[model samples]
Target: MRRNDHSINRAACYRSKIACLVFFAILWVAFYHAPAFAHKVTIFAWVDGDTIHTQSKFSGGKRVKGGPVAVLDSEGNELLEGKTDENGMFSFKIPQRTELKVVLKASMGHLAEWKIPAEEITGSGSESNTPETVEKASDKTSTGTGSESIKTDVEVLKPTIAGPGRKEIEEIIDASLDKKLAPIYDMLANTFDRGPGLTEIMGGIGYIIGLVGVALYFSNRRRKE
Candidate 1:
């Protein structure tokens, strides 16, 4: 029964190939489990004074290291871009005061976005209306040449006064809070990127086993034929 021997040899060859493929697949999953379950991409952002900070992570709290990040304005125009650090964190001085959208591109085609409302963005826009309004008010008041008009100009100027000590105070407060809240921010990012639960992991394992069973069943069926 050389025919029988040939069929058996063919089946053995097929089994070997399947075994090799399965072994490599399992090895890959073991080595890259973080990115294997990386479908859940999360990004979080906050403004600290004039700077916007973002943190990104994949499933299992794996930092999205070296990933590209884009900062876009309200109109979807790219403002600036940067890459995440080892800590999955990136920071940039607040771009334009418009609403900002930060997009992170993680490994394996994963993407996450975070938005900062315009009101939360500090600093003036490209044009500061305060200076223009005061200039116009001063020009108008000077034409009158009266004490009342000068007093009105003073009132106009008072509102535009860039409270000098205010910025220093804000810097101090931000520095203090930055140190205190670093861990909290990390915790929140990790919590959001926790990915699947134990139940889901077990379900995945069961699915893999089902696949292996199906492969074995077909192989045996082919041999029977």
Candidate 2:
């Protein structure tokens, strides 16, 4: 009778240990496979013109909040507008052909305006020219007055030109904004996707440890029984 009771208790302990192990294993697996889904955005502003402040905000391929506020335009049109939080901040959702003016009101009646050229405000314009290199021939001929031909290398650099149309202008702004916000987006996406994977692995480890604890507990309990 005593041996039978001891064996029964040992069996029960083993069953409990197995149950705990399975529970932890399932939890760990669930954690490891969890989806990552969180995002946040940051906004920044640059004063492009004396009266124009270009503010852009972004998060997860969307706009954030704030604006491309124009405090004054060439026509004296005062435009003040706030951006959508869902869209991230500065948005180019306006009509392609319509010209946009932004106005901003600062503290104590301070005001500023920015006039984004139509082409520059749109994305359909040609790329602006950057400086170009001009190599002059180094061969020099005497200018006849004992002065050798002053053959020097001359580099002619071109000034950058603005985009040609509203659509192009908008495209340029978007491209510039993207360049600024790319790093932030990369970090957020990585954290959102990788965070869950790490959490799951940790949970799995915890579960395995729990399984060991359960086995030890059962063993001790069976001895007492």
**Top TM-score hit:** 1
Which ranges in model 2 have alpha carbons more than 4 Å from their true place?
Answer: 1-53, 56-80, 83-89, 96-99, 125-225
Model 1, 112-219: lDDT tens digits are 899888766743222323566556655664576653644565577685753323234345656777668767876676676556789999999999999999999999
lDDT of 2 by residue, 1-225 (tens): 999999999999999999999999999988784322224333333222112223432234333233334333446654445543333234333332225555543323334433556554333332332123111111112324312211121112222432133334345666677667666654543343222367889999999999999999999999999
Single out the weakest 10-residue window by summed lDDT for candidate 1: 161-170
TM-score of 1: 0.54
Give the true-structure RMSD of model 1: 12.7
RMSD of each: 12.7, 18.4
How much lDDT does each candidate structure score? Answer: 0.75, 0.44
Clashes of each: 0, 40
What local lDDT does model 1 show for residue 208? Answer: 100
Q: For model 2, what is the C-alpha lDDT against the true structure?
A: 0.44
For all predicted structures, in order, the TM-scores are 0.54, 0.23
Q: Indicate the TM-score of model 2.
A: 0.23
